[model samples]
Target chain A: NAGLTDVREAVAGSLSAESGVKLSADHVVMVCGAAGGLNITLKALLDPDEEVIVFSPFFVEYLFYSDNHGGKTVIVPTHEDFSLNFNELRKALSPKTKAVIINSPNNPTGVVYSRAMLTELAEVLRQHTSDTGNPVYLISDDPYKKIVFDGVETPNIMELYENSIYITSHSKDLALPGERIGYVAVHPKCADAESLMSGLIFCNRVLGFVNAPALIQRAVKNVQDVSVDAEMYRKKRDFLYGELTRIGYSVVKPQGAFYLFPKSPIKDEVAFVQKLAEKKVLVVPGRGFGSPGYFRISYCVPDKVLEGSIHGFENAFSEAMK
Target chain B: NAGLTDVREAVAGSLSAESGVKLSADHVVMVCGAAGGLNITLKALLDPDEEVIVFSPFFVEYLFYSDNHGGKTVIVPTHEDFSLNFNELRKALSPKTKAVIINSPNNPTGVVYSRAMLTELAEVLRQHTSDTGNPVYLISDDPYKKIVFDGVETPNIMELYENSIYITSHSKDLALPGERIGYVAVHPKCADAESLMSGLIFCNRVLGFVNAPALIQRAVKNVQDVSVDAEMYRKKRDFLYGELTRIGYSVVKPQGAFYLFPKSPIKDEVAFVQKLAEKKVLVVPGRGFGSPGYFRISYCVPDKVLEGSIHGFENAFSEAMK
Candidate 1:
């Protein structure tokens, strides 16, 4: 009755084991996708004007998702190295802050948060909850959780904090974005976890998702262990990152995910991306992701496509410099 | 980009022609399901505390859908025959009323509204709209439009009224409830039609559906012209109705869809339904649907199952009387 389908439980259990989180099937709420999970969780946790602090360079959809539930999005920029900026994040916390979303193997930047970083962040949240009595939850948004590079492990939020929630999709890991399949797992230790799960189920219905499309749920059930070709993406990311850095662009080496974020030669990343697009190369400006002076190149395409785009990347950056 | 996908437009066109409504692809919004469509449309139309008048014996979810977006649901009781009680509906209308939802070939009661009833209702709306100068849009929820009996015609809502929106799911007609695919169509003549379309598309995205499941959308595209065998359901409805009537149950004959609504033998519809369930026959109590003194039995089942339920219904009815 609580969206306790056997297949949903199967994947939830599999995910629980992998994340080292003690989650029963009752803690799992199947949703349309990670976005659906996030929206519903926000809907459950927020009242009008509640603040949800998000790390900068986050998924742009976070702003809209937070606003949809009548919540304010307080964006705090990460450290210069694209890692957790505890100083600024601590400054951002308030009684009004209902949650802080962490998207590791993070979008745009492609930087994965280390376990130590997450452990400290949880401690900060714990202190805030005790001091303010506001229960500022940590929400882990983990689309690239399974897409880590060079054996970098994504932290399981449930391990770090009793008040954390997880919203993740098989979009990247299982390559099922078009399928719109994901699940929300509440840690057993999450405050009022049972009631929160129920609230999510209610939001799922009221938001009109009703439930995730059933066919994919069945497919996911049978193939819960299988995943997309992560090695292929890793190679592509390496090639793209190596080429851009050799071309004299300042770029952080991505530990996971399929995107390379390189500093634009020009001050305006949007203009730089525009030039790139004109040269038959496509990239999203980092400004759109709340991180200026950098642009994101998705390395999810065939190697040949990446190989062909090398010249465009060179031409666009050189042209932007001129 | 607009959410006007090729397949979405194809089905929208097919539904437009079939329903005798003049609608372009721009008017259609492919949603998660009929419920999804309803929620988004309500989100688009209703402001906080605005009133949405719904008929009694309605789908229980209507209240929740309206309330999800801060709209107040005003339940107007239907006629004793379970048809439109226009007098009550008219009295229920006020400046606060933003819209009215009509679920014809209705759920729970299975009442397929006649064209005359709809024409009069539209006239009532016209008068109200003119008197208050507040455009109260008519929202027709038509899941059972394709499953009508006795050759009753579903009103071409656009022809009956200029200001209307039609939301329906293929779940019933295409036997695809698990598929969770449907669309919302604004009449070409609807006031602020362009804005309404934009509003629906905006609501579709912000509501976290992002879009309907692509797999089912593609499937429905080519199968737009095909529908489940309504005759099969018609036969089942007849069988269920005949058996119940023979057993001295007072029930309304369903014109469409696959349900029988019979007055419970006991005053407490919930207890009566509980008794039926105790006899291994499951039915929804009328109170659940805002329509008490009755219970609903879905006839979308095998003939043998209906045959098998005979003794249980008889036993449950007799026990309820005692």
Candidate 2:
């Protein structure tokens, strides 16, 4: 249930090379996807009613995944620029807070947490642990780690936090979400890391993801160094970011991932999204990501589709603002 | 999260053809494997502390799968011949009995449930449901359905039970356990079948499967009618059954799958198993399947290995009896 050893070894090699930290195959558990990894991790770490703190504008599924294993989700709002708000986090941490989930090159928002940001976040967690005598885990969900724009490299969470569990999938990096292959790596230096690894392996089986698809495990074993061209997504991001801003929409310039989380011209993003939909422009309401007054546009579509949406976006923004 | 349309349609076609029941793509939900299907089914059907009945000499994983969804396992023993023991089943039924899981051709015992037996079993469940005004779902786990021996065609539980949910994987039949492809087919006439399907689809995502591996789903769509040749397994079953019986092992002749459940010469099947292992012939103690005084031999090995194990089996049996 841990995973194919060769695949784990390949992953370990890549993770070590990228982070400059030594990792062995024993640290990894193969999973169906980031989703599977998160579920198993929560199953292993959570007891009844334990709190898992997730930053606002988070992937919505984090709530469900935490709840699946009897963990309650405590949503803490990020800063206006979607950076870590350590003051809010400090107030949120409690003895019941078992883990904190961070998605870098995050879903919906596309804001990449830098090394400085992660280090500060790690310090907050360490301080909480020292004060409460309760260790809080940092779960880094990094499916979009390789999909960054502007030559930005997502920081390795393992290097910044000893009590970190790094989870990632080839979904965005390899553009293979449908293949359902990923791994969860426990930081070997974490408190009771060996016991945590055992719990992960046990949950992997009992949770019914016996192992990742064997075909993909073998297929990706040799391709650990390979990834989809982020430049292509970057091009799409540039066009959409530029067009949306030109059309009077206020959007944060995304650093990574193929999403533009633009403030709605109106306060109610769902109403604004409906207006966009009426103009034949579709986007997810920011409320779906636990943020209001904004909507998320995915720019991963074909060039023609992105180009075509320009007029619709302009009309929707003009009408909503009016 | 339900699954690829074409794949679900293909499975529906095969299930309809095999069961002589009209089924639509809507009735099917693709899952990671039989294991995934069972977890989701239990998740959808169970309330906390509800009971799930399993026939002992059962797949050991069923306990974990049931508990994964807050359902407790209530194991009712089978008859001496390993058929459904209705009297025991009747006594085991309660208002809290949410589901009963049956595997046939069985796992450890390899005893296929005849249609007459299933119809009778269905009747008992129906009676209990009517008495308590609570629906008792029949979950048929059929990974070994196509691996029957001696011209035995496994009966379709869906046709016999209106509230049945049929779950099977290509693991044993297509030799694709590593690929982890499977589907769950809800009986069209099942109580609240539509709601149950929605619950299943919801559980599919919340439980972290999202969907079965998409690559294998497409790969197996065209091969639903294809299965590994049963005669190959039948031959191996015959060889092992014949040899073990000739060596004075009191074994129930298996009718399906690749297992032989034989009575250990000593009441302590674990000790008997150890003696067999000492002789270099490995088998599982029946207590692993919630039955004692017996051991299970899986005969899916090469013929040479089977032949080589005869002396070991003979020595272990003689030593245990002495």
Q: State which candidate has the highest TM-score.
A: 2
Question: What's the TM-score of each model vs. the native?
Answer: 0.93, 0.99
* CAPRI classification of candidate 1: medium
- Using DockQ, give the best candidate's number: 2
Task: Name every residue pair that clashes in candidate 2.
Answer: none
- Write the residue-wise lDDT of candidate 1 on A1-322 in tens digits: 2353897689777867777886678888877888889989999999899999999888888998888778999999887779989999989998899999999888878899999999999999999999998888789998888887788887688877999898888888987666678888888888888888889888888777888777777778777677786788788888888888877889888888888888889888888888888889989989889989888888888889999999998887777667
Query: Local distance difference test, per candidate?
Result: 0.85, 0.91
Q: What is the per-residue lDDT of model 2 for residues B1-322, given as tens digits with 9 covering 90 to 100?
A: 8889999999999999999899999999999999889998999999899999999999999999988877899999988989899999999998899999999988899999888999899999999989999999999999988888777768898888899999999999999868888999999999999999999999999888988888899999999999899898888888888888888888888788899999989999999899989889989999999999989999888889988999999888777777
Q: Give me the candidate number with maximum lDDT.
A: 2
- In the order shown, the chain A TM-scores of the predictions are 0.96, 0.99
What's the chain B TM-score of candidate 2? 0.98
